[model samples]
Target: EDDVIWTVLDRVEISDDYTVIFHWKAPFPYGKAMIAISSLINYPYHIYGKWAEKVDPTVPVEEEPNKSLVASLKEFKPPRPITTGPFIFKTATTSELLLVKNPNYWAADTIENWETWFDGVLCRPHMADYNARLNNIMAGEVDLSFITVPKETVDSILTVPGMRFVAPPTASFFDLDFNYDKYPCNILEFRKALAYAIDRRAVQEVAAYYGFPIDKYATGLPKTFEEEWLSPEFLATLETYEYNPQKAEKILRGIGWSRGPDGNWRDAAGKQIKLAITTWGPYQDWVLAADNISHQLTKFGFPTELRPMPPELFYDAWDRGDFHLRVWYVGFWSTLSPWSGYQSTFGWDLTRPESLSWKGRRGLNPKDAVWAAFLVDRLGRAWKPEEQKLIVEKLAELHNKNVPLIPFVQKREYMFQLDGKRVTGWPDPDDPVWDGVTAQGPQCYTTLLVKGILKPVR
Candidate 1:
């Protein structure tokens, strides 16, 4: 009911003791995903509901200090844990956290093969000194490590006996997002030209920890999930881009950007076309990718600046849509929210008019923002599954034509290597059900594998 109230259900009626019926405002077939998230679970209304406040962006920032509805959500921490998971908190310190398996967990007697393998689990504090942690893992002091490493370091680690490496493609990715409000970037021809001029394959090679295999560069949606989500007719209409300098040059010429006396490209208004690419400095891959893009854009006769700042400053600048072109990643898979598919990240098409915010809290206004917003808003309010797909098809068409963001390389990833001396049966890359992504630990497709799946090789 919590999920449906925003878009689908009109009201929930208490039918009987064990049953509650949801009355939909419209006929909605997309409730399966919302239901899977337990969106109808009742919260403690008597205790916390009083703190709820309507958070509207129209409220002035100065006034928000006192008027925030979520101020209590952050300020208040309950006296004890209140969750129905398999673990129970026991003790904690600056250096460690200890938890014991909830032996009296609700399903203990009724569930099959549901006993926890560990009686207790201890987690060490997150270490900032990555080198020290890596060294300890090499010395067998730590059983596993998940921190990302350089290409050379990854190769060296693979040579360590009793340790194995696994790379899984996560939902995250790096991309080049264009700000529609920015000058030349607002032009479709310019955006498409940049897509063709930049050698994405080369950028992937320099940015990737592992060599950039073709499979690793398929950008945009996960091809594995595409067949399930994208309609065949819509998929067929999608436009694809590849590296072609001549095509880029032709497109730029058609858009009225021409070579000037300085031999650099210039707009009709005589301003030398310049682009700025920024990223957080802590992200080494993004810095390299930005630098690589700067060089490519320069070679294509567009002056470009690369700004690599601390994460805080970079994120603030990104949130303001202050750059002509920025290289970053935006995702829909993580949030799984229909509206956010377009409203998040650079928000190239988000716009607010007539007291209505087209996007989310940020109130981002991008020149290309509203058409996608209109379709997405309808998608949320849509009643029928077929109607929702029709809206998605239109959304896909806008995505291909707008070029708000260009997904260059898929975030093909590597894994946490467990010392073979400590554990085994960490499934390899091609075990079918679990590709080392999605599911975690010894569970494959949520089922515990035989021999515990992850056994102690020792």
Candidate 2:
């Protein structure tokens, strides 16, 4: 054997996940985080290996020489443990998943005392079949389900004897995404114009009112809940996006867009000042939003075209930057940085060369500033309290000004009902903190004491 020999590197356990840190005798950042998200069940992951061939930077899949590959395998199909209270993942299949009681589950002993008042707990996570799931719940086939049933359907479902309802807030939002990579929208005035023409209040009343209208909350974070991690100053800064169609029109008119004989706005070149926006087909709400916005934009001389694409094609066009505007949920998750994961939203990192259309989306090219702040925070570089506050405040202002994405609604008091007999240890719906319990709920983990179901018995 050669004088060089492989040696065990460093190892650290983050929560339950084991992370191996291999410090190669040589320099290579390539394999550092390579196996972070391996499909444990079906795929074998190579810790460190050589490329099969030379990789082409321009190509989607570079051909690397003798490269290591990680593949998902059938034998490793055990459900990975989760941390959402008492809902352990048991047997998972393509169509459905069954969750049995973890005999040694942390909650097992805790809930055994509750069994004196009820039966053992069981949880079944159904796939994306809403109608079938709802029918099962109604026919007494299944005990409970999570569904966004329509208003009329809910009235009928509530009539079922054992059924109860829990309305908790959800982390869903609606907003108009400007294709900054393209022309027209590449101009701030165009975005302001489009923003002016839409009637969000009406749209919320019609589309999002499931039963009630979206509450008027600033900062895009819902007022229905609170998070200590969010700074009060930053939350207070969210008021800049208040709806004002009058100002929207003034901004558009100031940009030299004028009304044409045909009753639409035309640019200086007499070309219609219109944009082609696409939304997912059958999303009646988005379609309605498009229509209302289009109608308003036309008044300001900006003609609008609303194109409905099939769900697949709709997302494809968005990723491709083919549309000028889009109406969808702009997800926001609060992490260490105020602008965590914003690179994909505001930065000009496109998969394809043609998609480099949103190049200048981030208003003042604040990438360097935003990213520097992120690194400083992560690296924990020493700085004065005022210095840190200054950096965070500047980052927040830049983020809001860029408007790479807009916020419409924050998570609200949305709830789901379950039959108590089949599903035990279900978080109480009336609990204010319970609304924030599930991942989808407004709160990280609804205030339920679900330590047992979240972690595996292992």
Candidate 3:
């Protein structure tokens, strides 16, 4: 029901077999870009059209038709998965998946340079053990790996003959998010103090070798967009939140917190503060960062612990706001717009003006909830860049003042390995297309494949 597409779309009209027209609820400036970059599944109408035809496209989810549609989809399962892409799924196992080229792809003969050269593609599961994946890449058993190579292993991976590494800029980043509804985290001063106590550079060095420390201002936008989207005057007004243990102590003292005999902080009620950061056990970097942070906070007079849970339990905990703190990703979508960044940071879009509760876990204060809804409405209505920029400045200011989440590292580059021995026509490192190959943008190899550029070397 919270599908982003439903926010802007009023209804869809199929004009012909090849064309579909979208009628938006309003003049949404990001409507086109939103659809283009969205990872929405293309469900086959032939199999589900009967159930879909029962629903009124214009009706809300709570109302009739939508709820029925949802129930119908939940029960309906196709006999076989279908795809209209360049490849069709052939087989799958616990460790691997195989896809063969689609002979009936619509653009095969009609479009220029649309031929698919590779007969099939094999995908290996993301091995939790980094060394195992590294060994496969180095041995040339793997043709291409989407895994990010650890910084310590980059030199060794480069030694492999015909090994090509592509480091594309990432749209996401790692952050330490405070559970706003939780105890000490709920206090603004304590949140600020914790922000000042931790070293972002240290976290980046330990967790994300290819990442850059977030800008000191922490305006909720990546440093890359600050110059383009933020005014010089606005940027100067933001708090640096630099690492200062003394300042953190001062803030704690001011807030009626005192250091006990054991060097742990005691709150105004004489209770010792002990916090825990929950992270996904599978994400080695996040686990390391959480451990490092726990040590730093513990040393700074707060007894902190690292609770690394399995992926399933970790996500459940995150969704239920079951932890004091957590290490997670916070950032924008593929587009260069600040709207998505602010949305991700504040979850402004999650709040409806008519509702008292936010849809997501990050419990926002009442005032901020109202402000978030207002900004979301204003941004949706705003079409011009100049108009959108004005609202973004306000969001940045709010985010800076209220430390909802502390961004530690911005993923500057994502490492993916490509074996040139088996595959030819992969983009050269110096190619201009490499610049556009971001984590969210058109992948270089995938772009090459669709354009009929990649071919078997043998």
The model with the greatest lDDT is: 3
Range of the 10 consecutive residues with the lowest summed lDDT in candidate 1: 355-364
Question: Residues 1-458, candidate 1, lDDT per residue (tens digit)?
Answer: 12323454565666886777877666555455454432535345455656643444465533764356556466777666654545578998876677777777765554445453545556555533456666766666555555555677777776677666666654445678776656776567787788788888788777765523222222244433344456676676677667888988998788677898777898767788878988877666778888999999988899889998777888888678677777777544423443334434323323335223322312223433555556655775677767766765666566666565666665555555554565556665566544434323222322332335654343
lDDT of 3 by residue, 343-420 (tens): 555545544542454324344577886686578667777988888889888877877887778888877555454556
Model 3 worst lDDT window (10 residues): 353-362
Instruction: Give the clash count for each candidate.
Output: 5, 36, 0
| Residue 336 of model 2, lDDT score | 21
Q: Pairing residues by index, what is the TM-score of model 1?
A: 0.71
Error of 1 at 391 (Å): 5.4
Error of 3 at 449 (Å): 1.0
What lDDT score belongs to each candidate, Candidate 1 first?
A: 0.60, 0.49, 0.74
Per-residue C-alpha lDDT of model 2 across residues 212-301, encoded as one tens digit per residue: 333332222233322423367666755354567677667767878666778676666767765777776655556666666666565556
Error of 2 at 440 (Å): 6.8
Clash pairs, model 3 backbone: none
Rank the candidate models, highest TM-score first.
Answer: 3, 1, 2
TM-score each candidate: 0.71, 0.62, 0.90
Q: Which ranges of candidate 1 are over 4 A from the true structure?
A: 1-30, 35-71, 79-82, 89-152, 209-220, 226-239, 260-263, 334-393, 432-436, 439-452, 455-458
